[model samples]
Target chain A: MASNLPVPVAESGDIDLVLRQVLQDVLGLSSERVAELDAESGLFGHLPELDSMAVAGLLTEIEDRLDILIEDDEVDGEMLETFGGLITFLSDKRSDA
Target chain B: MPMAALAGNWPNPPHADEYAVSFDSGRAVRLLIVPALFDEANKLRHFTVEVMRALDRAGIDAMLPDLPGTNESCEELAGQSLPSWHAAMEAAARHFRATHLLTMRGGAICAPTGLPCLRYAPVSGVKLLRTLLRAQVVSDREAGRDTSREQLLENGREDGLALAGYSLSPEMVRQLEDAELAAQDLPDIAQSELGGPGLWLRAEPDHDAAQTVALARIVAERLA
Candidate 1:
């Protein structure tokens, strides 16, 4: 685990880019589709592609890339409601880790 | 013959396998009963069987299904994504109308889909990934193999093996490496409603007290 690496304080734009990339890669969605994602989008209810398996798959990807651990209990749908919320949460987690 | 009792020799049996268990309601649940992953599975056979027998006596129908890419269920490990595995669990739950689901070690996440879940010595997928990556690094270093994180990811490009149990598809690997589960807010979605009561049973003197507490609190709050 790359736990020792200093967490990067990414700008909002950086967060947006990373979040979009993650969504694209994990959910098998295209950038064109993900580009329309806003801060208030519903991941499961809105996106037909985001099933339970996709959720788990997305979590695994995020953990590996961000070098953070997501306990099972932390996996609720609220954190994924909006793109901004997800980014903010990641930013906080990076700083904490 | 009924598949409820262990048929072979105890502990160091000639072979280990999963069988279907039936409930009084006449429902059946598929069980993926194998030894624990790595040496734990091998060493804990007696304890595992004892627990299974106890659960059986309690009238909880259970089965240890064959793992993907192993045993009679020769499903390709590459195709065994988390969703697929969950679906299998859901099928098992449906078969048994299981009110409670239990998993050991790496198989804990497989229990959360439908039934109320009870995890014994559960390990998170993220933690498992980190440990696997770290172990790969250490093993490569010791074995004098030129294995870098980049190489690991690259090898993952073809067919990446998770340290926990099964191998992941390239797409699955990339998805896992890039996405973060903790960042995703789940309570908002009605789907979080599906997570029934979750209880994490830990060994006495758990080293990760903070983590265990956090996990239990999170599950409790969400499922409440």
Candidate 2:
């Protein structure tokens, strides 16, 4: 007998898209604005909208959408420091999952 | 359109009057809108009102009621639990003579039984509590206080706790940790159908007219 569960796919491009969506949805950023964000674009402390409180919502939304769990200890300044950093963190989390 | 309070008479002593917003044109179809819980409630309020307005224009009546311990309700938030909320919603359904239920997010967990429920992004209560706890942790960290999620859970289960500005009773916290979305046969309005990401996940309260129109159209067509 085979399980009917869908296999989880870990794709960098998909992780990038997910992070963009989390930023846009959590911070209410426009699609065009989020699209312009590059790998080096600064996040935490840089974007006025991504305040400390919004970080909680952002991580929760990411965990829900990506089907991953983020331990409290894993959240820090580095993971959210740049656009690419979050994508990398999520990609790694998914690969681990 | 009228703003009023629904009287709750349950668990013995009657609960305080909870504020409610309704669009009534004396329509035959009545919908009781159970709002998202806590922070999600604030983020989706504008969208919820827009849906009610659209429903009114479509010749349907809709009501958005405040759960006890929330919004303008005279009851204390720290004293309200999930069971109390369920009772209040059941009373609201009765008071409004609702023919259907439109529950959003965490609201699905406390929706009254015996109605045709239409859910929009219904979520588990455990996830809601976790999000609140996570927010509290983030806030504490910003203030240079090192608090963990497990610590918060322990505190919440012991003497209750405050998260995201709302104080919770120990019972409420415990109940919420175990609450699950109940109705499975109901239809869900997916985010894709709404034309954008869920408004409830946004950092602040906002509205999307296209999403409102899409949601109201679905309700109108389904309930018709």
Candidate 3:
């Protein structure tokens, strides 16, 4: 009893790129700034653009774009701490999907 | 954009003027625009306007109405709840005589069950509130303080919680959190099949002529 073909998960790089697009769109960030970000680039407290209001919009955009459900309690400061960490979490979530 | 004062004044100090917009086509068909809630409303304004105009160009009538206690509505957000917002949209639909509905994002929560609707990227209520809560936490961090959901809920219970610049009552949060909404059995969903990217998720608050045209075409072709 096979559960269809195993769903192909996105690579971490691809995940990072897509999440960056979502962040740019949701946070009204310039394409340049979004491009400037790297795995170690700070988020949350570090990036002023990643403020309270923007976080909500950013997460909602991520959910819609990624087709994933982010639970209320699952949100934490760590996932949003760095670009690399966020991408890792997203990659894992997509794999789980 | 013809405006109507659906609800008059807040606090009853003297007079209030809560207004709604109806983009009239004077044609037989009319659409009721239920906007995305909270800060999303501000971000989506350009797109919303573009959609309304596109509808007009397609010879379809449309109405863009502000919910009670929002956007020039003369009422306090502290008194607003999801049910009240739903009822306001329902009343506006009747007032505009809209045959079809066009809801985006959280607006789907207020969609009238019996009426046919065209939803664009419908988001559930819990997702919407979770975003709000995140925004609250971010704001707290900016103020050099860290806050949690438990504290937020406690404050909301007392009076109301200000999240992402919108004051929401505890009742509003409770009902919206409990709500699980989507465009079910709707005539259409404005998806890639409609030939456009999601306008709401675009990077800038600028106009997307291509997407708007595609949306107008979809609404006219499917709903008609």
Which portion of correct inter-chain contacts appears in model 1?
0.00
**What is the Å distance of residue B89 in model 2 from its true position?**
1.1
**Which residue ranges in model 2 land beyond 4 Å of their true spot?**
A1-10, B1-13
Point out the worst 10-residue segment of candidate 1 chain A by lDDT: A49-58
Error of 1 at B5 (Å): 1.9
TM-score of every prediction relative to native: 0.43, 0.90, 0.77
| Residues B1-224 of candidate 1: C-alpha lDDT, one tens digit per residue | 12346332111111232234232323343333322332233323444554455444443444554444343443565765555555565555554455555555556544436455555555555444544454454445435565555567678768766543446677656655543332222322221232321111111111223333343343334434
Number of the candidate with higher lDDT, 1 or 2: 2
List model 1 lDDT by residue over A1-44, tens digit each: 43545446554466567667667654545568888888786775
Least well predicted 10-residue stretch by lDDT in candidate 1 chain B: B197-206
Q: Write the per-residue lDDT of candidate 3 for residues B74-133, one digit (tens) a residue.
A: 678878788777777777777677888989778999776567888877778877777778
RMSD of each: 16.4, 4.9, 5.7
Cα DockQ of the candidate 2 complex: 0.51
Number of the candidate with higher TM-score, 1 or 3: 3
Scored against the true structure, residue A10 in model 2 reaches a CA lDDT of 41
- Stretches of candidate 3 off by over 4 Å are A1-10, A27-36, A40-48, A63-82, A88-97, B1-17, B154-158, B187-204
**Per-residue lDDT of B46 in model 1:** 43
